[model samples]
Target: MAKAITQIRRVDPTPEELQAQSITKIIGALAENGESIIKMLDIVSQLDQTGILDALDAILKKRVDVAEIMIQQMNQPTMHKIMKNGMNIFKFLGSLNPEQIRMLMDGVGHGIDKATARESDDKKTSLWSLGKAMKKPEVKESLTMMVSILEGMGESLQREKDHVH
Candidate 1:
Protein backbone atom coordinates (compact mmCIF):
# COMPACT_ATOMS: atom_id res chain seq x y z
CA MET A 1 0.00 0.00 0.00
CA ALA A 2 1.15 3.56 -0.80
CA LYS A 3 0.24 6.72 1.27
CA ALA A 4 -0.15 10.27 -0.07
CA ILE A 5 0.33 13.45 1.95
CA THR A 6 -0.33 17.19 1.24
CA GLN A 7 1.73 20.13 2.59
CA ILE A 8 1.39 23.97 2.40
CA ARG A 9 4.04 26.73 2.66
CA ARG A 10 3.72 30.50 3.29
CA VAL A 11 6.16 33.31 2.40
CA ASP A 12 6.09 36.68 4.23
CA PRO A 13 7.51 39.77 2.52
CA THR A 14 10.30 41.62 4.39
CA PRO A 15 9.73 45.20 5.70
CA GLU A 16 12.02 46.67 3.04
CA GLU A 17 10.06 44.83 0.32
CA LEU A 18 6.78 46.11 1.75
CA GLN A 19 8.12 49.66 1.73
CA ALA A 20 9.19 49.28 -1.91
CA GLN A 21 5.71 47.99 -2.81
CA SER A 22 4.07 50.99 -1.15
CA ILE A 23 6.40 53.37 -3.02
CA THR A 24 5.53 51.71 -6.34
CA LYS A 25 1.80 52.04 -5.67
CA ILE A 26 2.27 55.75 -4.73
CA ILE A 27 4.21 56.35 -7.96
CA GLY A 28 1.47 54.66 -10.01
CA ALA A 29 -1.23 56.85 -8.36
CA LEU A 30 0.85 59.99 -8.98
CA ALA A 31 1.17 59.06 -12.65
CA GLU A 32 -2.58 58.45 -12.98
CA ASN A 33 -3.54 61.83 -11.41
CA GLY A 34 -0.57 63.89 -12.70
CA GLU A 35 -2.73 66.10 -14.95
CA SER A 36 -5.21 66.98 -12.18
CA ILE A 37 -2.32 67.84 -9.81
CA ILE A 38 -0.80 70.08 -12.51
CA LYS A 39 -4.09 71.94 -13.01
CA MET A 40 -4.46 72.55 -9.27
CA LEU A 41 -0.87 73.85 -9.13
CA ASP A 42 -1.59 76.20 -12.08
CA ILE A 43 -4.65 77.70 -10.25
CA VAL A 44 -2.50 78.15 -7.12
CA SER A 45 0.17 79.87 -9.22
CA GLN A 46 -2.45 82.26 -10.67
CA LEU A 47 -3.75 83.12 -7.20
CA ASP A 48 -0.20 83.89 -6.04
CA GLN A 49 0.53 85.99 -9.14
CA THR A 50 -2.67 88.02 -8.62
CA GLY A 51 -1.62 88.88 -5.04
CA ILE A 52 -4.82 87.27 -3.73
CA LEU A 53 -2.84 85.09 -1.32
CA ASP A 54 -1.04 88.18 0.04
CA ALA A 55 -4.35 90.00 0.43
CA LEU A 56 -5.78 87.01 2.30
CA ASP A 57 -2.78 86.98 4.60
CA ALA A 58 -3.21 90.68 5.31
CA ILE A 59 -6.91 90.21 6.06
CA LEU A 60 -6.12 87.35 8.44
CA LYS A 61 -3.53 89.49 10.25
CA LYS A 62 -6.10 92.28 10.83
CA ARG A 63 -9.13 90.04 11.45
CA VAL A 64 -9.69 91.17 15.05
CA ASP A 65 -9.46 94.90 14.27
CA VAL A 66 -11.62 94.50 11.17
CA ALA A 67 -14.30 92.66 13.12
CA GLU A 68 -14.35 95.35 15.81
CA ILE A 69 -14.70 98.11 13.25
CA MET A 70 -17.46 96.22 11.48
CA ILE A 71 -19.31 95.80 14.77
CA GLN A 72 -19.05 99.55 15.47
CA GLN A 73 -20.38 100.44 12.01
CA MET A 74 -23.22 97.94 12.30
CA ASN A 75 -24.29 99.53 15.62
CA GLN A 76 -24.96 102.85 13.84
CA PRO A 77 -28.53 103.88 12.78
CA THR A 78 -27.49 104.38 9.13
CA MET A 79 -26.29 100.79 8.91
CA HIS A 80 -29.60 99.58 10.39
CA LYS A 81 -31.59 101.59 7.83
CA ILE A 82 -29.41 100.32 5.00
CA MET A 83 -29.86 96.74 6.20
CA LYS A 84 -33.62 97.21 6.55
CA ASN A 85 -33.90 98.67 3.06
CA GLY A 86 -31.84 95.83 1.64
CA MET A 87 -34.10 93.28 3.32
CA ASN A 88 -37.23 95.04 2.02
CA ILE A 89 -35.82 95.10 -1.52
CA PHE A 90 -35.04 91.39 -1.33
CA LYS A 91 -38.52 90.72 0.05
CA PHE A 92 -40.17 92.72 -2.74
CA LEU A 93 -38.11 90.92 -5.37
CA GLY A 94 -39.00 87.59 -3.81
CA SER A 95 -42.69 88.45 -3.94
CA LEU A 96 -42.63 88.99 -7.71
CA ASN A 97 -43.29 86.03 -10.03
CA PRO A 98 -40.85 85.14 -12.78
CA GLU A 99 -43.37 86.05 -15.48
CA GLN A 100 -44.00 89.45 -13.88
CA ILE A 101 -40.26 90.12 -13.71
CA ARG A 102 -39.79 89.04 -17.33
CA MET A 103 -42.61 91.31 -18.50
CA LEU A 104 -41.22 94.23 -16.48
CA MET A 105 -37.74 93.74 -17.95
CA ASP A 106 -39.13 93.46 -21.48
CA GLY A 107 -41.16 96.67 -21.00
CA VAL A 108 -38.05 98.50 -19.74
CA GLY A 109 -35.98 97.26 -22.70
CA HIS A 110 -38.64 98.34 -25.21
CA GLY A 111 -38.97 101.73 -23.52
CA ILE A 112 -35.19 102.25 -23.78
CA ASP A 113 -35.22 101.27 -27.46
CA LYS A 114 -38.10 103.64 -28.21
CA ALA A 115 -36.35 106.51 -26.38
CA THR A 116 -33.12 105.90 -28.30
CA ALA A 117 -34.95 105.74 -31.63
CA ARG A 118 -36.76 108.99 -30.84
CA GLU A 119 -33.40 110.73 -30.31
CA SER A 120 -32.93 110.73 -34.11
CA ASP A 121 -36.31 112.40 -34.62
CA ASP A 122 -36.62 116.10 -33.71
CA LYS A 123 -40.40 116.05 -34.13
CA LYS A 124 -42.35 117.23 -31.06
CA THR A 125 -45.72 115.79 -30.21
CA SER A 126 -48.57 118.31 -30.32
CA LEU A 127 -52.15 117.74 -29.06
CA TRP A 128 -53.08 116.51 -32.57
CA SER A 129 -50.18 114.11 -32.74
CA LEU A 130 -50.97 112.90 -29.19
CA GLY A 131 -54.60 112.30 -30.18
CA LYS A 132 -53.44 110.42 -33.25
CA ALA A 133 -51.10 108.27 -31.10
CA MET A 134 -53.91 107.59 -28.63
CA LYS A 135 -56.02 106.31 -31.56
CA LYS A 136 -53.36 103.73 -32.45
CA PRO A 137 -54.16 100.20 -31.24
CA GLU A 138 -50.69 99.66 -29.71
CA VAL A 139 -50.83 102.96 -27.79
CA LYS A 140 -54.35 102.20 -26.54
CA GLU A 141 -53.23 98.77 -25.34
CA SER A 142 -50.20 100.25 -23.50
CA LEU A 143 -52.37 102.89 -21.80
CA THR A 144 -54.90 100.23 -20.73
CA MET A 145 -52.14 98.08 -19.26
CA MET A 146 -50.67 101.08 -17.38
CA VAL A 147 -54.11 101.93 -15.91
CA SER A 148 -54.63 98.30 -14.83
CA ILE A 149 -51.21 98.21 -13.16
CA LEU A 150 -51.92 101.47 -11.29
CA GLU A 151 -55.31 100.13 -10.14
CA GLY A 152 -53.70 96.93 -8.87
CA MET A 153 -51.07 98.97 -6.99
CA GLY A 154 -53.77 101.11 -5.41
CA GLU A 155 -55.64 98.02 -4.27
CA SER A 156 -52.44 96.57 -2.79
CA LEU A 157 -51.78 99.82 -0.90
CA GLN A 158 -55.31 99.73 0.52
CA ARG A 159 -54.87 96.15 1.63
CA GLU A 160 -51.58 97.07 3.34
CA LYS A 161 -53.31 99.89 5.16
CA ASP A 162 -56.08 97.58 6.36
CA HIS A 163 -53.52 95.03 7.55
CA VAL A 164 -51.59 97.73 9.43
CA HIS A 165 -54.73 98.95 11.20
Candidate 2:
Protein backbone atom coordinates (compact mmCIF):
# COMPACT_ATOMS: atom_id res chain seq x y z
CA MET A 1 0.00 0.00 0.00
CA ALA A 2 1.38 3.47 -0.96
CA LYS A 3 0.70 6.82 0.80
CA ALA A 4 -1.64 9.25 -1.09
CA ILE A 5 0.22 11.96 -3.06
CA THR A 6 -0.60 15.40 -1.49
CA GLN A 7 1.76 18.03 -3.06
CA ILE A 8 2.15 18.95 -6.78
CA ARG A 9 5.07 21.18 -7.87
CA ARG A 10 4.97 23.47 -10.93
CA VAL A 11 8.50 23.99 -12.30
CA ASP A 12 9.24 27.34 -13.98
CA PRO A 13 12.18 27.91 -16.37
CA THR A 14 15.02 30.15 -15.11
CA PRO A 15 15.96 33.36 -17.05
CA GLU A 16 19.10 31.64 -18.41
CA GLU A 17 17.01 28.68 -19.60
CA LEU A 18 14.53 31.02 -21.38
CA GLN A 19 17.39 32.90 -23.08
CA ALA A 20 18.95 29.62 -24.25
CA GLN A 21 15.59 28.47 -25.67
CA SER A 22 15.18 31.74 -27.61
CA ILE A 23 18.74 31.45 -29.01
CA THR A 24 18.07 27.90 -30.08
CA LYS A 25 14.93 28.94 -31.97
CA ILE A 26 16.84 31.82 -33.69
CA ILE A 27 19.70 29.49 -34.74
CA GLY A 28 17.24 26.98 -36.16
CA ALA A 29 15.53 29.73 -38.19
CA LEU A 30 18.91 30.96 -39.45
CA ALA A 31 19.85 27.46 -40.62
CA GLU A 32 16.52 26.92 -42.32
CA ASN A 33 16.71 30.27 -44.21
CA GLY A 34 20.46 30.50 -44.84
CA GLU A 35 20.15 31.24 -48.58
CA SER A 36 17.45 33.90 -48.13
CA ILE A 37 19.47 35.55 -45.33
CA ILE A 38 22.57 35.64 -47.54
CA LYS A 39 20.63 37.24 -50.42
CA MET A 40 19.14 39.83 -48.05
CA LEU A 41 22.62 40.64 -46.75
CA ASP A 42 23.93 41.07 -50.30
CA ILE A 43 21.15 43.58 -51.10
CA VAL A 44 21.86 45.46 -47.88
CA SER A 45 25.58 45.58 -48.74
CA GLN A 46 24.80 47.08 -52.17
CA LEU A 47 22.50 49.70 -50.66
CA ASP A 48 25.16 50.61 -48.10
CA GLN A 49 27.81 50.91 -50.81
CA THR A 50 25.57 53.24 -52.83
CA GLY A 51 24.93 55.46 -49.75
CA ILE A 52 21.22 54.75 -50.17
CA LEU A 53 21.04 53.22 -46.70
CA ASP A 54 22.41 56.47 -45.17
CA ALA A 55 19.93 58.53 -47.21
CA LEU A 56 17.05 56.31 -46.07
CA ASP A 57 18.17 56.60 -42.47
CA ALA A 58 18.33 60.40 -42.75
CA ILE A 59 14.87 60.51 -44.34
CA LEU A 60 13.47 58.40 -41.52
CA LYS A 61 15.02 60.79 -38.98
CA LYS A 62 13.19 63.75 -40.62
CA ARG A 63 10.01 61.96 -41.61
CA VAL A 64 7.72 64.47 -39.88
CA ASP A 65 9.28 67.44 -41.70
CA VAL A 66 9.11 65.64 -45.06
CA ALA A 67 5.47 64.73 -44.47
CA GLU A 68 4.63 68.34 -43.63
CA ILE A 69 6.28 69.65 -46.78
CA MET A 70 4.43 67.10 -48.93
CA ILE A 71 1.13 68.04 -47.33
CA GLN A 72 1.79 71.74 -47.92
CA GLN A 73 2.62 71.16 -51.60
CA MET A 74 -0.47 69.04 -52.19
CA ASN A 75 -2.71 71.63 -50.53
CA GLN A 76 -1.92 74.31 -53.15
CA PRO A 77 -4.69 75.43 -55.57
CA THR A 78 -2.69 74.40 -58.68
CA MET A 79 -2.19 70.92 -57.27
CA HIS A 80 -5.90 70.64 -56.52
CA LYS A 81 -6.82 71.61 -60.10
CA ILE A 82 -4.23 69.20 -61.51
CA MET A 83 -5.63 66.34 -59.43
CA LYS A 84 -9.20 67.19 -60.54
CA ASN A 85 -8.21 67.31 -64.21
CA GLY A 86 -6.38 64.00 -63.89
CA MET A 87 -9.48 62.41 -62.35
CA ASN A 88 -11.66 63.76 -65.18
CA ILE A 89 -9.25 62.37 -67.79
CA PHE A 90 -9.28 58.97 -66.08
CA LYS A 91 -13.08 58.97 -65.98
CA PHE A 92 -13.31 59.88 -69.70
CA LEU A 93 -10.86 57.08 -70.59
CA GLY A 94 -12.77 54.64 -68.39
CA SER A 95 -15.97 55.44 -70.32
CA LEU A 96 -14.32 54.57 -73.67
CA ASN A 97 -14.15 51.03 -75.10
CA PRO A 98 -10.58 49.65 -75.05
CA GLU A 99 -10.95 48.01 -78.50
CA GLN A 100 -12.03 51.29 -80.10
CA ILE A 101 -9.12 53.09 -78.46
CA ARG A 102 -6.69 50.43 -79.75
CA MET A 103 -7.98 50.77 -83.31
CA LEU A 104 -7.79 54.58 -83.17
CA MET A 105 -4.22 54.41 -81.82
CA ASP A 106 -3.17 51.98 -84.57
CA GLY A 107 -4.64 54.25 -87.24
CA VAL A 108 -2.90 57.28 -85.76
CA GLY A 109 0.45 55.43 -85.72
CA HIS A 110 0.10 54.46 -89.41
CA GLY A 111 -0.92 58.01 -90.34
CA ILE A 112 2.15 59.38 -88.52
CA ASP A 113 4.44 56.96 -90.39
CA LYS A 114 2.91 57.92 -93.74
CA ALA A 115 3.27 61.62 -92.94
CA THR A 116 6.92 61.14 -91.97
CA ALA A 117 7.62 59.39 -95.28
CA ARG A 118 5.89 62.17 -97.19
CA GLU A 119 7.90 64.84 -95.33
CA SER A 120 11.05 63.98 -97.36
CA ASP A 121 9.13 64.13 -100.64
CA ASP A 122 8.88 67.62 -102.25
CA LYS A 123 5.36 66.91 -103.58
CA LYS A 124 3.16 70.00 -103.63
CA THR A 125 -0.56 69.57 -103.05
CA SER A 126 -3.02 71.69 -105.02
CA LEU A 127 -6.79 71.95 -104.61
CA TRP A 128 -7.14 69.68 -107.66
CA SER A 129 -4.87 67.09 -106.11
CA LEU A 130 -6.92 67.20 -102.89
CA GLY A 131 -10.12 66.67 -104.91
CA LYS A 132 -8.50 63.68 -106.59
CA ALA A 133 -7.57 62.27 -103.20
CA MET A 134 -11.18 62.68 -102.01
CA LYS A 135 -12.23 60.29 -104.75
CA LYS A 136 -10.13 57.44 -103.24
CA PRO A 137 -12.08 54.98 -101.01
CA GLU A 138 -9.58 55.20 -98.12
CA VAL A 139 -9.57 59.01 -98.16
CA LYS A 140 -13.38 59.14 -98.34
CA GLU A 141 -13.64 56.69 -95.41
CA SER A 142 -11.24 58.80 -93.29
CA LEU A 143 -13.14 62.01 -94.09
CA THR A 144 -16.44 60.37 -93.09
CA MET A 145 -14.95 59.19 -89.80
CA MET A 146 -13.52 62.65 -89.05
CA VAL A 147 -16.87 64.31 -89.70
CA SER A 148 -18.65 61.80 -87.45
CA ILE A 149 -16.18 62.49 -84.61
CA LEU A 150 -16.58 66.28 -85.03
CA GLU A 151 -20.39 65.97 -84.93
CA GLY A 152 -20.27 63.89 -81.76
CA MET A 153 -17.91 66.38 -80.09
CA GLY A 154 -20.11 69.33 -81.09
CA GLU A 155 -23.21 67.58 -79.71
CA SER A 156 -21.45 66.93 -76.40
CA LEU A 157 -20.29 70.58 -76.16
CA GLN A 158 -23.85 71.80 -76.81
CA ARG A 159 -25.23 69.53 -74.10
CA GLU A 160 -22.59 70.79 -71.65
CA LYS A 161 -23.45 74.43 -72.50
CA ASP A 162 -27.16 73.75 -72.03
CA HIS A 163 -26.56 72.12 -68.66
CA VAL A 164 -24.46 75.09 -67.51
CA HIS A 165 -27.38 77.44 -68.11
For 6-73, candidate 1 gives per-residue lDDT tens digits of: 76668899999999999999999889999998999999999999999899889899999888999999
TM-score of 1: 0.70
- Tens digit of lDDT per residue, candidate 2, span 57-142? 99899999999999999999999999999999999999999999999899889989998898889898789989999999989988
Model 2 weakest lDDT span, ten residues long = 117-126
Error of 1 at 76 (Å): 2.9
On lDDT, the leading prediction is 2
For model 2, which pairs clash? none
Q: How accurate is candidate 2 locally (lDDT)?
A: 0.96
